[model samples]
Target: MKLKNGKMRKMMTVSLAATMALGLLAGCSGAKTPVSNQEKVLRIGVLYGGNMDDSYFRQQYTDIYEFDRKNVKIEIVPAINQSDWRYNDGSEPYKEPDYLDGMKKIMTGSNPVDVVVTDVSVLKQLIQENMLKQLDPLVQEDKFDTSDFVPAVIDGIKDLGEGSLYALTPSFSSSALFYNKKLLSDAGVEPPTDKMTWDDVFNLAKRLAKGSGKDRVYGFSFNRYMGNDPFWDMQYTYMAPLQLRMYDEKAETMTVESPQWIKAWDTISNLVKEEVIPNNNNVNYDENWTPISNDMFLSGKVAMMISESYYINEIADANTNAAKIKDYTPVDWDVVTLPTHPEKPDIGGNIYLNNTFAINTNAPNPESAWDYIKFIAGEDWAKLKSRSNSYEMVARKSYIQPRQGLSYNIGAFYNIKPVPPTNPKDDKLKQEKRGLYYVENLGRTYFQEVLDKKKSSTEALKDWSEKGNKMLQEIKLNPKTEFQEDGTPYIPEDNVSAAAGLSSKG
Candidate 1:
């Protein structure tokens, strides 16, 4: 999640800005009927966020629902182990030897949760296997009015089950362009506007980039993992704006080495070699080696960046933490529209949904679980969540409004149409084949080689097209036939870059 600018002299660390791409919170009074006594204790078993007691859960419950309520006792059932929660980034790889084992235990074992929170992908898997309770009947019986929800979000959920509404989200994460107002001011350049093109952003970065040696501050940066996933990479660039997909879902064929993708790779490769954009090493350069994208911008190390809605809360947290060490003035920052592709000036950002809610097919208290899920998605939940500034927008259109205190351009968050998943098997491609990391890793190696001067950008991209084509072909053909993770079908990991015939990190 990153941007462009000019150069001249030494600069002071100023509070930078953050822009998120999602959101939720609010209060409700008129919508629902009273809860029945049988639904007093709501046991929710979250599939991924282990223990179901993370700060996000507690805060939402206590602040919004007011824990220990006279009418309801919300208990996160099926206690999870501290070390078992695993989020597979590239380095660790995606391996789930115990896929849904915990949730299964909750369903079949003595202690179980009535509700579950999991990723959209996992929910889709469950839906396909008929392991989740259908919510349409409940909605109809209660006369639950869902017209307030963002239709795309609701449609996305229904699409997971061929037209069955099996799940929904209280809020979603989004991506946007954030800029340092002071940096642009110092460069004698105007800050980014809501309609800047990619070239426009790069030029701004060049103008704001200044100094040399250790004092050198490059013009732009980004979220470190952008290039590691094909779908995400496309979303972050040209293909998404035009609604292009690498794989044709209807035909079930791979469409790689295209003009749009190739041109994007060429453009990005040149930028890296010129040092217009920082490498992975620089972007994640914290001494502690933690994931701190916001700190780089917050400390004025970079002028602009892309970030999820969650970064807004991070900005507030970092400022509060820094204030304890000494009095520190926050950097002035704001947001603009994300850069647009010249080919598709009308398009803006590629919006992706993160977390969602579903019920176990064997849920003992499905009604109560429905109540909890409905409450979270209802107007009251959105009203309360809005004030938290967590960046996740409620899935409702009316609740999607500006934060009370922030002065940035909030419209950028919703100005563009979202790039939805193009294929039903997109998630399967990402997980089963580790296709995300594979293509991402391959492209990254070749792209970075250009920056290292080991190869020309032309040479790298040509190699990329060929090797990427081969990989996409295998990925398209490989079927999720077996449940065994190790014996899965995918292009075997290679020890060298097939394009340059050099040893690779893969």
Candidate 2:
């Protein structure tokens, strides 16, 4: 991808929570053991993850999962969805029946699935059903040194029980704040600083947003999230930046009604009302152009956006595409650190795991499955993954540097800690078990009311909190709700203003 700086780099590695995976699966793994010509083939199950068409799954399938070995032949079974109920970020709850039923068949069928390359919701549901193997045994037996694995990578795979290790991630995805230099300058607003607070950022956004209706400019927007799991954008980009969460797992309660949470909602509400950040309704994609229009950042209709590094490629291609069309000028943009809270001025936005791998316990070849998971999640694979077009950085620290030279704040991405889950581990399961579809389909209704001006922010959140709590109460009553505790983001500098330094670098 050619950046404004004219440096070409392959970009858009994201598709995670939006990036990791293979050069080809041939020599990426070191676990291939010699086997006779008659060696049995290892069958692997690949599930539906985000952006399947251009995702890490495609890379991993070609590179690591489908990796070839002299003695051991490998066969991959791409998960087939017989039903139309996809995990579009909890958007369709009624479809859960079709989804769960399909997955159960895959794991427990006559020809059972082995290792899986899947999204978080699939892994979470598998773990809840005790359908996955405890990988500690394999890790110990293989003497796999997992110390190199990123802490958050491990945390994301913890099961509801003792939070045991049941899954592992091969790559890491995160968000950074992208700004339009022309918009900022035109508004007479200085470019944002790396350590700027949300309040300060919002003020800049308001100033940069101008015009009326169709030709108007927006202050902020983001890349479309995996529809399967939607609320993350709200949590990671909005609330977590302020050190807030919708639910407090440790307390076994909902935090959606808290003052901080309310303020977070109102802040967004006010932005929508003031037309700084247009509501989702106003962001329309041209059917001919599809995502580009709705992707306001690339549409060049937004001044600032919280986007995964994947855009590092998309934006570049956007310019090329724009030049081919009539009357479209390329977006003049650069990036800075994501906005931080006044109190937690140094943290980065929430980080998400990408290409996370897991094994099904009922598989006939659990050992082989473990081998595949470890190989892809280990160092050898990391080397190739780092260089891929993934927008997300690989988990390996050494691989986490900016591509040779395109002029963007690559450091801004690594500048902070990720926000960890605050709820009880079991509660986390209860939500995922139901697909968080309820939260997405139901909760968002009330939240949208506030955005549409039909209900006050406080009133909307309070109502959702009450209704959401009742749903949780019913979920907790399920026999599978037993489980326990577990774990859980950036920035810096001289008084010269980190934002200023970022602008200079740009």
Which candidate ranks first by lDDT, i.e. highest? 2
Evaluate candidate 1 by giving its C-alpha RMSD to the native, one decimal: 10.1
RMSD of each: 10.1, 14.6
**Clashes (candidate 2):** 25
Q: Pick by TM-score: which candidate is best?
A: 1
User: Candidates' lDDT values, in order?
Assistant: 0.59, 0.60
Candidate 2 minimal-lDDT segment of 10 residues: 483-492
Give the lDDT of residue 168 in candidate 2: 77
How far does residue 212 in candidate 1 sit from its true spot (Å)? 3.5
Candidate 1 lDDT trough over 10 residues, lowest sum: 1-10
